[model samples]
Target: MQKGSLENHLFRKGQEPLGWELRLKIAIGAARGLAFLHTSEKVIYRDFKASNILLDPVYNAKLSDFGLAKVGPINGNSHVTTRVIGTYGYAAPEYVATVP
Candidate 1:
């Protein structure tokens, strides 16, 4: 963990569309991290996206800020379970819809 900032990533600051390689790398890292949290640990990520993912010196990703986590699932874990509470844009689409 090199403790780099997530805000520096191309997505966080919205520094325009990224070159395919950098963009793909970020997506891959995020998905890989999410897969681990979702299945490897049997934990569903109530919140996901660029803002919550920090980077190390080498740009390796580290999932950070898990305040909204739940034992089962965050509000949007279901299609009709409205109970939204997450950052704008970065939150998963399903989760965002839960806003009430």
Candidate 2:
């Protein structure tokens, strides 16, 4: 994302008015990135939301903050993370179930 490009949430505000085409495209890009992470890479993006979607000047979206992400489970050990992480209202439903 660019240094000063509009963020997904701020752009969504009616008063902000980030033209329709750009918004839609940004949304699509964000979805594709997430899909790549989950299906193609067999990973779980435990956190996702408009705020975390950083957009460039051309409305290109990028996923940020993978530092907390863990690789897919290999051992029989539980992936039931007890960390209780992620931003509110954007955390995956499955994550909440796994955590204490």
Question: What are the models' TM-scores?
Answer: 0.64, 0.66
Model 2 regions lying over 4 Å from their true place: 3-15, 75-83, 92-100
Q: Each candidate: RMSD to true structure? A: 5.2, 3.8
lDDT digits (tens) for residues 29-100 of candidate 1:
888998888776756577675667777776667788788765554465653345776678766797677666
Model 2 per-residue lDDT tens digits across residues 26-77: 7899899988987778577766767677877667888887865666665765
Indicate which candidate wins on TM-score: 2
- The TM-score that candidate 1 achieves is 0.64
CA lDDT, every model vs. true structure: 0.67, 0.71
lDDT (0-100) at residue 96 of candidate 1?
70
In candidate 2, the residue pairs with backbone N, CA or C atoms under 3 Å apart (3 or more residues apart, or in different chains) clash, namely none
Q: Output the TM-score of candidate 2.
A: 0.66
lDDT of 1 at 89: 77
